[model samples]
Target chain A: MKKVLFAMALALAQTAWADGGMDILKSQCSSCHNLTGPAPQTLKELWARKGPDLFYAGNKYRKEWLVQWLQNPTRIRPAGEFYEDHIKPGEKHDEIDPATLKPHVSLSKDDAQAVADALMTLKPKSDLIAKEKIEEGTISKSMGEMVFDKFLGCMACHRIEPDYGGLSGPELYTAGDRLQPEYIASYIRSPQAWDPKIWMPNKHVSDMNIQKLVHYLEALSQENKNGK
Target chain B: MGNKLIFLTLLALSLPALAKEAARDNYRTYCVQCHGMAGNGKGVNIRDMSVQPRDHTDAKAMSARSDDTLFKVIKEGGLSIDKSVLMPPWGDTLSDDEIRDMAQYLRTLCKCKFGGN
Candidate 1:
C-alpha cells in the first residue's frame, strides 16, 4: 500500500511543479514572449514581435542561464530589440537613444525558477539539429578570429565582447553559457530556417568550420567568465 | 487659370525631388547606422566593421556604377553584386518603389549620373 501510494505521489510531483510553472508563464511572460508559436511567419509579424520567441526556449537556451538571466535581467540587443526603433540622427553618426529603450523586466527568484521550468518545457523546433553529431572542435585563436571577421564577416554585426563589434546583433561573449552547442551550430548554419525573416544571413559555413565556430563561442564564453 | 497652371507645373517639377527627399528618411533609418548620417562612409558602426560602408558622396566612384546595379544591390544585397554581405538585403523590408527611390537618392548624393559601365 505504501509503494502504490508513493508511486501516485511521484506522478503528482511530476505535474505539480509544472502546473505552477505554466500558471506563472501564462500570467507574466505571455505578454511579451511568444509562448505558443509558429515563429513570426511574415515581416509584419517580425516587426510586431515584442520579445524573443520563447516557444523554442527548450531547444535554444541552457536552463541555468535562463533562470539567472530572468532574475537579474540585462539588455541583450545593443540597439534595442528592433534596431530601427530607437535610432535617431546624431551630429556625428546615428545613435541609439538610450532614453527610448526599456530594459528587460527582472523577476524574483521564485518567479524566475517557475518561468525557467516552463520555458524549458517549450521545444517547438527539435528537428533543427546537426545531421551528424557535432562537438566543440578546436580552433586556433588567430584563425578563429579571422574566420569570424575576415572570411565570414560576422563582426559587421555580432560582438564577441562588450562594446567591441558592430551594434546591430546580440553580444556573443556569453553565447556558450546562454545557448546550447547544437542550437548555436544550427542557428549559424541557417538563421532563416529558424526565424525566416530575421536579418542574419545564411552563410553556408562548412561543417568543420561550423564546429570551430562553436568552439570559438564556447571559449569566448569561458574567457568572459574568467574576467577577460 | 494661370496661377493654377503654374502651381501644377511646379508640383510636377518637384514630384521626383519629393520622392528623393522621402527616400532620405529610409536612408536615415537603415543606411545611416553603417553609411554615416552624411553618407560619407564614416558611420558609427564602422569603427569595428572590417569593411567600410561605401561613401555615397564619392562622385567619381559612384559614377562608375549604373543605376541598375545600385537598385540590384539594395534590393538583393551586396552579395548579389559580389560585394560584402554586411550590406544586408532590404527586399523584405523596403518596397520596390522605395528601393527605386533609394537608388535615385544615391544618385543625388553622388551628384553625378551613371551613364553605364
Candidate 2:
C-alpha cells in the first residue's frame, strides 16, 4: 500500500512537469508567442501593431479568465487594441466567427494546464499593480449616481436606464439585475482579470469611490423595480 | 449696472476655458471602436458582439446619468460599476485626471448632460 501511494505521488509530479514542460509550450504557443522569459521585444511591437501586447500574459491576467477569453475572442476593448483611426464615419469593419475562436479548439487537461502555467510567467517591464489604500465613502443613492456620471465615468460604456454614456464599454441598464456588489467592486478596481487585452483607459479610483459606485450600481435593479 | 453686465459677460466667455478638457485621444485609443467617433455606440466592433452597443446620442438616456456615475464607470469599469462584463476596467491604464478629460469629451459628443439634452 505504501509503495502504491509513493508511485501515485510520483506520477502526479511527473504529469505536472510534463504538461508545463517547455517542449509543449514551444510546440503550441510559440508561433504567436515566445515561450522563453523576456519575450522578444520585436514580437511585442508587432503584436501591438496588429493587436494587444501579450508579453505580460501571466502577471496581467488571471488563469481562469485567460482560459475563457482565449476561447472567446470578444472585443473587451471597445476600440482596436492598438489605435483608432477613423477619418471618416460609418466605415465598415469585418466580423469574426465565434465558432473559430481558440477556446473552441479542444485541448487535453494536461495540455491546457501546461499552457496556462507557461503563459502565466510572462510579466511586463513596467509595474502595473496598484498598492495604495483607496478612500472609502458612505455608500448612498444620490452619491452613487453622482459618482457614476460625474466623477468616475460609468456612462461612457454602460447604458443605465435613463442615461447612455458610451458604447465602447457595455450596457449597465440592468446591472442591479446582473451582478453582485462585491463582484462589481473587484471588477471596477481591476478589469484585466476578465480580459488581458482590454483597451479601456485605466483611471485610478480610490477604494471609497469604488464602493459608493458599486453600492449605487447594485441598487439600479432593485430601486427601479420598487419605484424608488 | 453696465460694469456688472460686462463682468458677467467676461466671466461667461471665459467659462469654456475652465470647462473640463476633453481627452479625445484617450477616447480614440480606448473607446472609439464600440462607441464610435460620434458616441453613437455603433463602433466597428459592434457588429460582431452578441449585444449591440448602446447609442450615446440618445438624449433620454444621457439625461438620466450624472457626471459622477460616468466617472465611476470609466475609472472602475462597466462590471465594477454594475454595468457590463464586456466593458473592462480602465482604472489601471489611465489616471483620474485623464478619465475626467475623457468624460468631458464624451459629454461633447453626446451633446447633452445629466438634466438637459
Candidate 3:
C-alpha cells in the first residue's frame, strides 16, 4: 500500500516538473503552429498552415537563435508562411498591413529558454542533418556574392543585405547567425524535403556549389557581426 | 441600342488601363525589390549586386529592345536571353497575359514603344 502511494506521488511530481516546457508550448505556440512531424506536402496543404512547422526545430535552427527569437520574435518570412493569403496589393510592393499582422508571442527569458529546450527535443528526422563541419572563410565575400547573385539568382527571393534582395523569403544576410550550417546546406540542397510546398525551388545545385554557398553564408554572417 | 454600343466602346477603351493596373501590381509584388520602387536600377539590392539592374526609364537603352524580347525576358528570365542570371524566371509565378501586360507597362516606364524608332 505504501509503495503504491509513493509511486502515485512520484508520478504526479514528474508530470508537474515536465509540464514546464510542454505547458508553455501548449499555451503559447500551439494555436498557430504545428508541433508535430509531416510538414505540408502540397501547395494546398502549405497554404492551410498558419505558421512554419517546428517539428524539425532541432535539425533546422541554432539554439542561440531560437532562444533570442523567442524572447523578441520577428517576422522571418516576408510573404508570410502562406504568401497566397498574406500578400495584398500595395503601391510599391505587395504588403502585409502592419496593423493587421499578428505579432509573434514573446516570452520571458526563462520561458524562452524552457521553450527552446523543449523545441530542441522535437527531432522528427534525426538522420536528415549530417555531421558536417563548417569551415569558415572557405569562400570570399566577392565570390560568394557572385555565386548568390549571378550564378544562382538566390537574391530574387532571399535578402542578402538588410536593404537588398527579394521580400518573398527570409532575409539571408543574417543566415549565418540564424541557422545551422548543416541545415543551410541541407535546405539549399533540397528545400522540398524539409517543406515540400515551399516557395524556394530546388535549383539542383551541385555538391560543390552547395558547400561554396554555405561557406559564403558563414562568411557573410561573420562580416555582418563585425559591423563592416 | 446606341447607348449600349457607347458603353461597350467605353469598356473596350478601359480594358487596357485595367490590364496595366494589374501589371503594375505584379511589378510591385515581384520586381520592386530589385528594380526599385520607381523602376530605377538602384534597388535596395544594388549595393550587394555585382551587375546593376537595368534602369527601366532609360529610353535610349529600352528603345533598342523589341517588345517580344522584353516579353521573353520577363517570362523566361535574363538567362533565357543570355543576359545576367540575377533576373529570376517569373514564368512560374505570373500568367502569360500578366507578362504581356507587364511588357506593355515597361514601355510606359521608358515612354518609348518598341519598333517606333
Candidate 4:
C-alpha cells in the first residue's frame, strides 16, 4: 500500500515538472491535432469524419469546460468507432488522485489560461465552409447518402444509408433532425466514453474539419426538414 | 496473329497481379510488424499503439476511395491522407513503385475496383 502511494506521488511530481503541460501536448497531441492553421486536407469534413478537430478551442468551448474535460474525458460518439474492437464499451478513467496525474500534467492556474488562450487562436483560414446555413430544407436525404458513401467512410461501421457497411457504430440516417452540428462537431474530434467499455480508436480530428462536415450534414438535414 | 493478340492480353492482365504479389511481399517484410499480414490491422505492434492502425479488410469502406487516394495514403501516411496519425508514411523507406504496388495489393484485399487507373 505504501509503495503504491509512493509511486503515485512520484508520477505526480514528474507530471508537474512536465513543462507546465503544453509541451506534453505538443509532443503527444500533434499526432492527431494541430494548434495552428492550414490544416491537413485529409482533415475530417464532418460528413466523412472518423475523429474530431480542435482548431477553434476558444470559441466552441468554455474555459471551465475545457479544464474539466481535460482532467476527465467522456465518450461523445453516439455510434462509437467504425470498427468494433477499437471502441471498448463502458471503459472510463477519472482523475488519478491528482497526485498520479500531477506529475504528468502539473498546470498552474496561469499556465492553464495561457494554454487555453493559445488554443483559441486555431480557426479555419477560409469562411467558405464556416458560413454554412443551417436553415430548414438545406440538408437533403441524397446529401446524407453522398456523405455516407463518398467523402467520409461512414458506411465502414454505420447503417445510415442501409447496407452500406458494418454495424460497428449507431445509425446516422436521422442525424439530419436528431443532432445539432456543433454537438456533432465536438463529438467527432474527441469521442468521450459513451459506454466506457466501448472499443473505439481515437482519431483526434480538428475543429475546422468538423465545421465543414457539420455544414454538410446540417445542409442535408435541413433539406430533409424543408421537404418534410 | 491471333495467338500474339491473346498473349498480349493475358500478359497485360497478369502484370498487375504480379506487381501486387511483390507489394504484398514487401509489406509483409516491413509493415506486417505493425499493420498485420492480412491488413486487418492486428499487427504485433498494434497493441502498443496509442491510435489503432486501419484495417485493410474493410471492402466497402476501402472501395469508396480512389486508387490515387490509397497510393497517397501509403506513400504519405494516415496523417497525410488525413486519417490516423499513427500510420507512418513509407515514402522515405519504400520506392514509388513499391508504394503503388502496395496500394494495388490493398485494393485487392478491399475488393476496390472503382476509379480509372
lDDT of each: 0.78, 0.56, 0.74, 0.49
lDDT tens per residue, model 1, A1-228: 999999999868756766788898888878878888877655456667767888899999999998899999887888776676666667756677889788888888877877787788888788886453576367766788787877777887788888788876788889989998999999987786677656565666788878888888888888889996
* Residue range A1-228, candidate 3, lDDT tens digits: 999999999877655544677678877787678888677644456667778888788787888888898899877766565554554445543454455457788988878777877777777765768645555548888999888877898987788777777666788877888888888988887776687546565666777788899989888888888988
RMSD in Å for model 1: 10.1
Candidate 4 docking band: incorrect
Residue B61 in candidate 4, Cα distance off native in Å? 18
User: Each model's DockQ?
Assistant: 0.18, 0.12, 0.09, 0.05
Count of backbone clashes for each model? 0, 45, 0, 51
Name model 1 segments beyond 4 Å from true. Answer: A1-11, A130-132, B1-33, B36-44, B57-60, B71-85, B88-113
The better candidate by DockQ, 2 or 3, is 2
Model 2: per-residue Cα lDDT over A43-160, one tens digit each: 2332344333355555444565454445543444332324343123555532223333233244565565566565666554224333322244445667776787666655645556
Select the stronger candidate by lDDT from 1 and 2: 1
**Descending-TM-score candidate ranking:** 1, 3, 2, 4
TM-score of each: 0.78, 0.40, 0.64, 0.31
TM-score of chain A of each: 0.91, 0.46, 0.85, 0.33
The TM-score obtained for chain B by all candidates, in the order given, is 0.79, 0.73, 0.79, 0.71
Locate the minimum summed-lDDT window of 10 residues in model 2 chain A.
A38-47
lDDT of 2: 0.56
CA RMSD of each candidate after superposition:
10.1, 13.6, 11.3, 17.7
User: Which 10-residue window in model 1 chain A sums to the lowest lDDT?
Assistant: A129-138
Residue A177 lDDT in candidate 2: 44
Candidate 3 chain A: worst-modelled 10 consecutive residues by lDDT: A91-100
